[model samples]
Target: MAKTFKYAWLSKLSASSSALLFHYFPLRNLGYAAREFAKQGLKPGELAIISKEAVAPYERPALSKAYLFPESPARLPGFHVCVGSGGERLLPEWYNEKGIELILSTEIVKADLAAKSLTSAGGETFSYQILLIATGSTVIRLSDFGVEGADAKNIFYLREVDDADKLYEAIKAKKNGKAVVVGGGYIGLELSAVLRLNNLDVTMVYPEPWCMPRLFTSGIAAFYEGYYAKKGVNIIKGTVAVGFTANSDGEVKEVKLKDGRVLEADIVVVGVGGRPQTALFKGQVEEEKGGIKTDASFKTSVPNVYAVGDVATFPLKLYNELRRVEHVDHSRKSAEQAAKAIKAAEEGKTVEEYDYLPYFYSRSFELSWQFYGDNVGDTVLFGDSSPESSKPKFGSYWIKDGKVVGAFLESGTPEENQAIAKVARVQPPVQDVDQLASEGLSFASKI
Candidate 1:
């Protein structure tokens, strides 16, 4: 179901509040900000987080990874916030113990930045001196593309715990049935593998030529494509699902392709992409690159207003450009940085601005891959990509201005991944492309 935002005002809280945060999702960013605010000696009941989800902040990345495991999917409290960062999990009790009010299942129906006020769907209003907006992103649906039969009962989109729960139940109910995974991105690929593991005949469909076209080169995509093929996952590229045929029960029964092909499908899952949720503050704040524009400190145009997570398009100090990162690492780090900046401002102290390097990773079956830094410049593929190899270990390096600016590795050890990050940060000069490709991991290790 889609959520519609409406603006209305009926009641208002006393204008005695000090700080407030509004996040549409139960994001780890809120938990991180709460902990940082406590560390800064902010008193209990001084800050609050208004969330649209009833659950506490939890690890979202696991929703695609361990949360889909057929045997024992990850449950609540296990993947709670801060736990994913190797810190103590912040449960509901933890928030209460810290005196931070977590107003869950509330939607901000109206936002008045000039007056520093927010009115919830219940007509309750809250005022604040400082505000943090971490609205996150919304998944793009097939309805957005005008695809037919999107209202089918068996079709799904993975975004929240509720969505995941529905998919999990469907997986159990549709065992040994056919599945069609729409899109070739991380969610599509990972979900296809998990569905296959659940004993479903999965067929991945994407309009792109290969998986992860935004980052993965053709050579790198080939490895994973072949691997999925070996696992009995049919990949249909260069075509898209134009419509769907549903049974009398309103369940999707077949997928219609553009190339005059129709495939049977017991279930359908779509993961095209996401759009940053910043419409609530469209004219209230500066906007850029499809997100709320923020400074290096994550401060927005409005005084005492800061934006973080997927909705913040802040300066990428490493790349000398403004970019909005949708990954979890940036979400957590930006929240912590913004909290620190707010604390410092109150105390008349200065904190360092955020300087983040891009990092992304995904895991499926027995394969895991990690990428670091900007993927610009000439590409150099290295290591072994052959499926026949006992251990398929391979990587790629991006050379720019005769220096290594980015890297990617599949099945890399902890230290090896760390080395690649360092190489990206330092950007060591490469004397020769052939020699650099030949050296591969050795070059990063030396860096």
Candidate 2:
């Protein structure tokens, strides 16, 4: 099956003097980049190769969402690149049809930026005139922090398709069991909700006072915390998982906390966070904030080498600072912009610099929230947050310099969400804090 899929994506090749290479994971960014380059009239023999460590390019985000559902699990070709962006799915056959090479399960261990070459773990060297690095990020594991019993059988840290499979199987095998979710980020939150829905008694443990401390304000966290509690999920905040105890079969039995509380657990899921996969080019490239440093065009210091997705820390033109965005939206746009820039450079033409607006969203249970722009300045939370509200609706506007710079909403209508996005884009001024808070979605609608 794997061999057939690989060859099905193999197209006619030619002896080209130069080639374009993409070293990435199963991310849509590289797919978009390849599509963009082809759209730019890349010659047939130019040689476009996409090498990935995964056996097939599938959706990574679904590993925490649809893949967890016991009834209908997401499978291959369904969640491939572009589909998530409302475009045609790029299956293995799609690559072959385009004459682009699809090199799966090939890990590029070494990259020589100056020489414009890469060395695979299998001792094969690939030379490229242009290289796009979209290796993405790696999930931080309990072993990274010296947490004991992390190697237990039922302990999982999901970052790939295989990891998701193991987690899903565990959920099936241990029905009505206890689950301990470590971390308070999107992964933890989403996984907890799904596990609880699967009949597992889930206990979420995090060191922050509320969930998603990185972005969710205390007011925003309160609603989610209350909602989860209502769903019978045990919340353990302001605490960290220190260790784990495994039974004789090497399955986690209990999770030890910093507060001397040991919670019984049949399964453990960790989502502490992840660091960019930049070690491959550690000294060979410039890095900022633990990610490869790039300009507005996603070009690295080394000529002809462009970095996109989670690996590149490019300048955020909107905020006038350097940032490495992890969201899928930024990854897609950055990859398209970088590919266009590369084509323009080849044609002796110049393109516009990337001017991106930060956007992030997460959906769990019946609730979904989206945030756009920076989360700085005074927060004006509006709408109903009470747990008893039949149709709960609430949002927050970040007021910076008397203007709305960021907005987050829960249960917002489509039009209301668009209004919030517009407010963030325009950074409209707020007349009065009290009025803005009272008006809520109305203020954004007017703007």
Candidate 3:
């Protein structure tokens, strides 16, 4: 069960100079960071995690995946922090035992970084000597675009547990109804599959020529589009939802497209994209690439303040550039890196700069794909990518300056995925593109 803590006791504990406050608790690595703090000699009541969420940090990605399962869906306490990454499930009791305060259901309305203080929406003020900003990102809403009937019920966007719960309830109520999923990115593909599994007629609409056009090549997208078609998913490309119509009860009923088409939708799931939640500290910190700029240690321009996860645009040592990644892997790793950096600085020591290898993956209805490294340069499609194959297995390689810069594989074994990752990192040279395509998985294996 989830636990709740009252802020009345916070007044007594806010005076410590060692106090470390986490602005939000959506990150799984927050638990790991807190543990690292305790291990580094921080005492009980010295660490506090403040979140607008009602519950402690859980696996946020599951909201669009397993949490929405029609049967045996994942729930709280079961999918808490660290569990998503095969680490310890840090339950609320664990925090209590560790003397870490979980300030749940609290929103920080004002942040005075210079004063090292945070003011909650409930008028509770908490002071901290060090701050870790993990506010993450907020989903881009249709209403933000002035779309009609954007406020209608049964229209959802998944980001937090509360959003997932609402979508799950809608899934049950609108059994066998039509679901129109907007956007063609990660959330769009995953949610569409889940909705279809729940017996809803799924139709995906995107403005791109193909799904996941940012990362997916035409050859790669063809397989998925074909597979989704076989699974009865309607793919409407090159258009977008211009507006939405609602029923008498204000539930979304129809989605009007820009290409002169209208789709009947009992439920609408919008996943266009998200913007980093950095407005709270806007102008107070250096900003770049739409995120708070930070050093290798995740330290912001201000002293004793750090930004991690989706909000931190830090140096990607691997690529020698400043970039911000919104994936869970980066979030988990960046948080831990910041914790270590903080502790090391406290001890007058230093930690190595973050060297990240970009990694991404997704799973749906027995289909899984993993990509590693940068997806730049020319591509080579390999193996049997045919959707109708009895056992479809295929991949692609991105060659930049005659060296493999990136690798993507579908339906790969654990060992195979690791091999591709190594290939991306090592970036082995290729003598010929056709030979590389023919080699496929073996090319990575030999590397």
- State the lDDT at 335 in candidate 2: 79
Better of 1 and 2 by lDDT: 1
Colliding pairs, model 3: none
- Model 1 TM-score relative to the real fold: 0.95
What tens digits encode model 1's per-residue C-alpha lDDT throughout 1-447?
A: 211111111111111122586664436778877778778887776777777777777888888778889888799989988997899889889878877777776777777889877877787777777888887888899888788888889899987888889998988898899999999998999999999889899999999988999999999999999999888899999999999999998889999999888999999999999988777777999999999899988889998888888889999998899998989899889888988898898889989979898999999879999999888889999999986677899999988888889999999999999999999888889889999889989999998
Q: Which 10 successive residues of model 2 have the least lDDT summed?
A: 7-16
The digit string of per-residue lDDT tens for model 2 on 1-447 reads 111111111100111112455545435666776677678876654645545445435557788888898677787767887777788788877766776666666666766668665666676566677777777777898898788878888999987778888999999999999999999999999999999889899999999999999999999999999999998899999999988999999899999999999999999999999877777678888898888899989889988777888888998888889998998788788878987898888779989989998989888888888898889999999999876677788999999999999999898777888888998999998879999999989888888
Question: 105 in model 1: Cα distance from truth in Å?
Answer: 0.8
Error of 3 at 266 (Å): 0.8
Q: Residue 188 deviation, candidate 3, in Å?
A: 0.5
Candidate 1 Cα deviation (angstroms), residue 125: 1.2
Report clashes for each candidate as comma-separated counts.
0, 0, 0
> Candidate 3 at 424: error in angstroms?
0.9
Q: Tell me, what's the RMSD of every candidate?
A: 4.3, 4.3, 3.9
Model 3 residue 175 CA deviation (Å) reads: 0.9
Error of 2 at 168 (Å): 0.8
TM-score head-to-head 1 vs 2, winner:
1
Error of 1 at 161 (Å): 0.2
